[model samples]
Target: MYERTARESMCKFCKYVIKIYGNQYLRKPNLNDIQQLYEVHESKHGFPEMLGSLYCMHWEWFNCPTAWRGQYLRGDHRHPTVALEVVASQDLWIWHVYFGVACSNNNLNVLEQSPLFNDIESGVAPDYSFEIDGVKYKYGYYLVDGIYH
Candidate 1:
């Protein structure tokens, strides 16, 4: 069936992407990357314990399967959509990206299911610390749009 072919093709593409750029771009930040981002964001942006900005966007799924069309629909969007979430730096380095699964069929749903926090929960996330004014903080925070609020 068309669904099976499409699914297989997507899986192949994902594997190719991981093989090509996963090690350099998809991996978490290193000690130096952490240090520089922390310092610049603190001094320049006044966000002392900042990591990066997190955003989620919806992409219209015009070719969505007939059975799943209703699942991805929203009140505002006339068509079904899938979500793409990214965490990026001011310098435009995409620190994180999550997409593909139909389970995350909207921005808000994507946020809930996103693996962005998995590294931290698994205790393998890079360790970084920063002070704001005079108070020392343990964890970094992202600058998110009001939709997340």
Candidate 2:
């Protein structure tokens, strides 16, 4: 939860920058607080719950393998050493996080036919939407490794 909370703060800070600067830095506030905002916004200016989920779910995060290694490795310094993007419901919990690597590296060919995919469901079938700040967001994640898209 600590990681999530810190991420929420960073996202919120980014969002604030975007609103005030008009995307000057291509900034976007993190939706970590989207749930809280969703609730408040709905009360003040209502929007459909489903829509809320969709909006909240449209976020991406970098899934770095180096970070997972528990040892700092100086990467190219200009690019993400390893990254992946995840899209799914919140907590949308990954049954096998390792599968993330296979997917991102395009190595799923060997893994997909395994029991991994069967055990790990993808997409929004289970629907794990949550409220942050007054907006409802669907939970999804993807790997991003660099500053430039």
TM-score of each: 0.67, 0.20
- Angstrom error of the Cα, residue 35, model 2: value is 43
For TM-score, the strongest prediction is: 1
| Clashing pairs for predicted structure model 1, backbone only | none
Which consecutive 10 residues in model 2 have the weakest lDDT in total?
50-59
Please report, in order, the local distance difference test score of every candidate based on alpha carbons: 0.73, 0.39
For every candidate in turn, the CA RMSD to the true structure comes to 6.5, 17.0
> lDDT per residue, candidate 2, 23-128, as tens digits?
4433222344345544655665664332132211111234546554332122323323333333232333222222223222333443444333443355423343
lDDT of candidate 1 vs native? 0.73
What does the lDDT read for residue 145 in candidate 1?
50
Off by over 4 Å in 1: 1-20, 100-109, 128-149
lDDT of 1 by residue, 62-124 (tens): 898899987777777888877888889888888888874563355555665778766655767
